[model samples]
Target: MIKPTLDEEKKETKFSKKYWKYDGLHVISFTKAGLREENQDGISIEFELNDKLKESDDRLKGYYLFGVYDGHGEHGDKISDDCVEHLSKYIAKRLYELPIVENEKEIKNAIKKGFDDTENYFKTHDINGIKGNKVRMSGTTALTVMMTPKKNLYIAFVGDSSVFFMSSNKSKKINIEHNCHNQNELLRLRALRQKGFMYSIKARSGRKYLRVKDDLSNEIQYTRSFSDFYIKNFFSGGLIAEPEIIDKVYSAFNLDLLVLASDGITDRSKIFNKHPTEIYLSYLKRYKGDPNRFVKACDEMIKLCDSITEKRICVDDMSIIIIIILNGKSEDEWCHIVTKNAEDPEDWDNTTHEDELSDIDDQDIYNQNSNEVDDFLVSVPLSTIPIEYYDEDSAMNFTISDDDNFD
Candidate 1:
C-alpha cells in the first residue's frame, strides 16, 4: 500500500475543529478533556476522499471515514493524535493497490492492517521514552467506521469507544467494548490463559472491577487497546493491540443519524441526566434530519457536560461525531426505501411505544445495564511505582492485594 504524505501537523490548532462532508454524508465532531488538565482525546472524520484517488478507483468515490481515539497515560495525547494523523493515509495507500471490486472483506482487512501498522509503529519506536531511557507505554480505545458508495458499512474498534446507527424507531450499537469485566472479553482472556492473572477490586463507589498488572506491579483495567504494554510483555495478547472488525452491506440507508462517541459522551453517572440514545434520537427529531443542525446539536450536548460542575460525579475526555445520512436528500423519497415501510405508525407492525422500548431494552440489555465506571481498566504501568514491588512479586501470580481498593 502506498503511504500518504506525512505532513501531519503536531500542533493541536492545525487540525479542523468543525466538520467534514461528501455528497450526502455530513459529519460534525467535537472533543474536550472535560475536567482533566489536558485533553487526551483525538478524532478524525474524512468524508471527502482525495479527488485523484476517487478518479483512479471508482469504488473509493463516495466512501466516508469516521474515527475516535481516547488515549490514556503520560503520552496519551501523542498516541491518539498520531493514530488519527496516520491511519487514513495508510488505508488509502492499501486500497490504491487492490483490484476495484466491491469486496467488503478485503476492505475490512485493509482497515485492520492500517490499525495494526499504526500500533506497531508506536510500540517499536523510541519516540516516547522516559528519563530512564525506557519506552513509555500508553493506550487508547479506537472506534472507526467507513461508509462506501454502495452503502456498505465496516466497523473496526478496540476498548470502550462506541458507534451507533439510529432511526426514528430504533437505535442499534455497532461496536463491542473490550473490558475485563465484560463476559465475552473475560471468556476470550480465559481462552488465552490470561484470566488467572486478573483480579477484581471493589471501588468506594460500590462498583466492582478488574485489573492486570505490569512487571512493576502496576495495574491496568481495559482488556484490549492500541498500546505497547501488551507487546512489552506487560500483559497478555488478550489485552491485544488489534481491533475487532465487522462488515455489512445495506440495501438502502434507513438510518436517520449515526453517532460515534468516546466513553465520556455516554457516561450516565455524570450530570448529562439522559442516555446518549435518548438525547441523540431527540436531537435527530428536533432537526428533522437536517445536516446543517449538527453543529448546534453537538454544541447543545457539550453544554450539558459543561453545565455539570455542581453535580459532576463523572468527568473525562469527551468526543462525538454525528453523521446525518439524509442530509441534502429527499427524506420522503428515501425513508420508505430505507425502512421498507410507510411512515405512518398505525400501518406498521402492531406494537406500542412501551413494546418498542422493551424490544430495544431486551436486545441491548447488557450495554444498557453497564456502569460508566466499568468503561476504564486499571492501567498503572510499572513506571508509576517503585521497583521493589516487582522484586517482591516477580513470580507474577495473579492474586488480589490489600491495596486493590479504589476508594
Candidate 2:
C-alpha cells in the first residue's frame, strides 16, 4: 500500500487568484470580495495520486482535485478557510485507505466520507478561537470535482455553487443547486414537517424568491450545506452535510472546458437573467480558437459581475474556476480543435428568460426585514474594495512565464 504524500499536494490558500498550466490541464481562477469587508470564498486545486493506484488502474493516473467553498454568516471566512485546508486531505485519506479500487461507487463513497468527516471535525473542534455556538451558526457550500487521466470526472456538491461542462459547442449543467426554489428540495423539506421552512424574500430588483427558514427564524437560501449546526439542531434535519455525487465520461476530443462557480456568478440577478453557462459559452465562442484570448474572456466575465456589484444590484462574493482540458495536446492545438468541432452559434440556446419568483403562496412570510437578508444585502460597494492579484507559481508541473503574468 502506498501512503499519500504531503509534499506533492498543491492546495492554495483562500483568495489566491492565479492561473496554472499542468500537463493536460490549464486553470484560471478568480475570487473577489463583493460589497463585503472580507472575502469568505475559498479555493483548493490539488494534483496527487499514489503510484499504487496508478498501477491498479490506468484511469487513475494524473488525477486532480479542485473545489470552491462559499461561506456565509459572521464567522463564514473561518469555516471556508478550514474547508480549504482539510476537506481535500480527508478525501485523499479515504482513497488511500481503500485496498481495492474497483468501481465508481467506492470512489463516491470515499468522497462522501470526506464531506462527513470534515463536518464532524467542525462539530467537535473550535475554529480560530470561535466557540461551538458561533461555529454552529457559520457554514459554507462546497462544489468539488476530481478529473482522471481518462477524461472521467467525479463531481460532488452541496448548496448553490454549480458546475458546468462545455463540449461540441454545447453546454450542460453537471450539478443541481440545493435550495428551496428547487422542487425536489421543497419536497424533502415538506416531508420533514419543518414549519415555516419556505418563505419569500424580495431582492434589490423587487423580485421575490423563496427561501428556507429554520426554527431560529434564520432565512437560508440553500437547503444543504456544511456546518450550520445551530440550524441543524434547531429543526429536525434542517440542513445536511451529505453531498450528491455523479460521474461523467467525456471523450478526449469532446472535452473542451469545465467550469466551477459560486452562486454570485450564476445568480440570475447578476447576469441579465441568462443562465450563466450560456453566457460563458458565448464568450468562449467569441474568442474563436485563440488560446491567448481565453483568459481575457474570463476577465471580461468577472468584470461584468464586479460592475454589477459596484452598482449595488446584488452584493455577494464571487469566485470562478475555468479549466481547459488539453488532452495532452498543446494549448493552441486544443483551442483549434475545439473551434473546429463546435457547432454554429445560431443553433445554440442562448435566450434570456424571466425568473420564476412568483411560485410561492401569498400567505407565506413576506420577509422584508429578515436579519440574515439584511446582513447579506449590505451596501458596501465593490469600488471601495481593492482587488488582490498573485503571480507566483502555485502548482507543481506548472510554468509561469513573464508574458503570462496576471494583469
Candidate 3:
C-alpha cells in the first residue's frame, strides 16, 4: 500500500496549493474546519494497484480509488480518520483475494464486502480504548469512486456526500444523498415500519432541522452510514451500511472533470445563489485553455464556501476533491481539446444566470444542525435509556453470514 508522505500529509491537513498528478488524473483536495473546534472530515486518494492484483490481472493494472468521509457525533473525528485509513485497504485486499478480476459485478461485490468488513470491524473492535458499543454512536457518510484501467468508473456511497460529473455536453450529480429528507429514503424507512422516525428539531438559533430519531431516541441526520452501530444494531433496516453502486464507462460519458465533496460544499448559503455544479462549471469555463488557472478555479470555489461561513452562520466542515481526467493526453493537450469544444462564454454564463434555483428551498438548505446546537446541547445533555437497551447479542458480534442482508 502506498501512503502519503509526511510533506504531502501536512499539505493536505492544511490547504493544498497545487494539484498532484496520479497516472492519468490530476487531483487537488482541501479540507478545513468550520465553526466546530475539530474537523471531522477525511479524504482518500489511492492511485496504485496492489502488486498482487496487478500480477493477477492485466486489466487491474491502472486501478485507482478516491473517497471522502463526513463524520458526525462525539467521536466523529476518529471515525472519519479511521475510515480514511481502513476502507481503501479493505477494498484493495478483497480485490487481491479474488481468483480473477473479471467484470463490473466482481468489482462491485468486492467493494460491498470491503464496506461490510469495515463496518463489522468498527462494531466489534475498540477505538481509542472506547468500547465498541459506546463508539457505535459515532458514524460517518462515505462516497467512493474506483476507476479501472479501461476508464470505467464504479461509484459507491452511503449518506449525503456526493460526486458530480462534468463533461462538455452536460453536468450531473452522480450519487444519491441518503438522509431523512430524501423522499425515496423516507419511503424506504416507512416501508420497513419505521414510523415516527422523522421529526424536525428546533435549534436555539431557531433554525429547525429534519432528522431521523432511532428506536433508542438518538437523533441522527443520515439514514445510512458506517460505524453508527447503535441504531444499526437495534433496527438494522432503519440505518444501514450498504452502499448504492453506479457504473460509468468512458465511452458512454466523455467526462472531463469529477468533483467529490462533503455536504458542506453543496449546502445552501446566501452567498451561492445557483447549484454548486453550475458554479463550478462557470469557473471551469472562465479558465478553459489554461491548466495552471484551473488550480486557481478550485481555490476560488473553496474560498467562496469559506466566505459563506464567515458572513453568515457557521456551516459544516468543507472537504472537496477536484479531478481532471487526462485520459492519454498531456495536461496542455487535454486543455486544448476542452477549449476547442467549449461552448461560448456568454452562452454558459447566461444559462447559469437565467436558471432558477428551483431544486433547493431556503429553509431546507442546511441539513446538519451541529453548529447551531453545540453550545446549549453541550451544557445540558439529553437523557438516555438504560444499558439494557443496548444489550449484547450474537448479532452485535458482527459475524457476516450468507443471510445477512443490508439492502
Candidate 4:
C-alpha cells in the first residue's frame, strides 16, 4: 500500500489554492495509488462559488462538485483522467445553460448527456500516449455529485465507485455498484439477454457471472462505463455509459460528512468484524469533527490496510472526498436538515486551520499531483473482473497479495 511519510505530509501542509470554504462546508480530498502499480483512480472536488464562479453567470453560486473515477484495463488511467477533465466542463455548461429552476429530472438528463458527449469525444479523438500508442479499448467507472445552495444534492453515478452521505448517526449508500453480482445489475443483464445483447454463466464454483459475449466466444466481465468500444460493438446493448442520477434535499446542519470513494476503499473484506462505515465512523469520532477529517481518515486507512495480512488488504487505487459541514450555522440552515442530536461543543477538536498556516504554498490541492501517491513499494497487476463476496464485510475488503500474478 502507498503510505505518505511525515516529511511528505509536512511538505504538503501548504493549503491548496483551490481549497475553498463557504458558510458551512469544508471539502477535504485525497487519492492514493494503494497497491496498484499505477494509480488508475481519478478524483475532482470543485467549489464554484463566490470568486470561483464565472462572472457571466453569478447565478452559479453555491455550487459544489465532486467526482470519482476508477479506471480498468491497461489504459484505464487515461480513461479516468479524461472523464474527469471533460465531465466538469459538460456539467458546468448544463448548469449555466439550462433554466435555473430546481428541475431534478432535467438536471439528471443533462448530466447523462454530458457523459454521452464525453464518451463520444473519446471515440472521435485520439488520446496520444507516451509510447505513441493511441488509447483505445479501456473503460472507467464514474461518480459525480452536484450540490447547489438551493438545498439540492444531485448524483450521477455509473460503474462501481461508491457514494455515501453521512449524517451524525448513519451513512447511507447513495448509488449502486454496477457489477455482475449485484441483484439489480443481474436484473439489468437479464433484461438485455432477452434482446440477445448479453448473457450469464456459472463458474465451477456455482457462482453466476454476467458477461458481454463476443464473436470469438469470449465472455468479458460486464461493467457500465465510458469507452471500451470493442465491448460496445459486440455486446449490442451489453454495456452502457448512462449514469444513474439521484437527487435529494439535505440540510447543511444535519449532514456531518459526505464521502465519495473508489471501490478500492469500499470493496474491502471485513476486518475485526467491522464494516467500512463503522471503521470510518471510528476515525470520524477520533477526529472529533476536525476539518481535516478526510486527510486523517486516509492516513489511518493506509496504516490499517498495510497492517492487514497481504490477502485481505485493499490493492486497487483508493480515492476519497470528505465534505465536512462546519458548525455554527444559522437556524434557517438547520430547518430542513433535521438531526436527532446536536454535536457537543466539548467534542470539537480545536486545531489551526490549514489555510492559516504560514508556510502553505498557493498550489491547488486537487491538482493532478494530488493523486500521484508514492513512498510504498511494489504494485499489483491490473484486474478487471469484479470479485463476488457473499458477506458484506468480505465485499468491502480486497485481496492484495504480492505473489499473485495476472496473465
TM-score preference between candidates 2 and 3, better one: 3
**TM-score, candidate number 3:** 0.74
For model 3, residues 1-407, the per-residue Cα lDDT tens digits are 54332223343343333357666667777777666677888888878657433455443456788899988878887898889878887888888766554577788899999898888878778777777555888888899988876677888999878788867745667766775445566567766663433322112122332121223234455678898877676675778888888755443137878878887777632134444555655666667667466666676677677766664333577788778877677766766655554443355332221122222212223334343323211100011212232222311111111110112
* Candidate 3 ranges with C-alpha deviation above 4 Å: 1-18, 51-60, 99-101, 132-134, 194-218, 247-253, 268-277, 285-291, 329-333, 336-407
Positional deviation of residue 299's Cα in model 2 after best superposition, in angstroms: 1.6
Clashes of each: 6, 0, 0, 8
Ranking by TM-score: 3, 2, 1, 4
Candidate achieving higher TM-score, 1 or 4: 1
Task: Please report how far candidate 4 places residue 365 from its true position, in Å.
Answer: 31
Q: How well is each residue in 136-239 modelled by candidate 4, as lDDT tens digits? A: 56778898888876656777887777777766566667665665434555566666655666433221111221222212113333357887777777776667
Better of 1 and 3 by lDDT: 3
Q: TM-score of model 1 relative to the true fold?
A: 0.69
Ranking of predictions according to lDDT: 2, 3, 1, 4
- TM agreement with the true structure for every prediction: 0.69, 0.73, 0.74, 0.68
Q: Which residue pairs in candidate 1 have backbone atoms (N, alpha carbon, C) closer than 3 angstroms, thus clashing?
A: 219-380, 220-378, 220-379, 221-377, 221-378, 222-377
Best by TM-score: 3
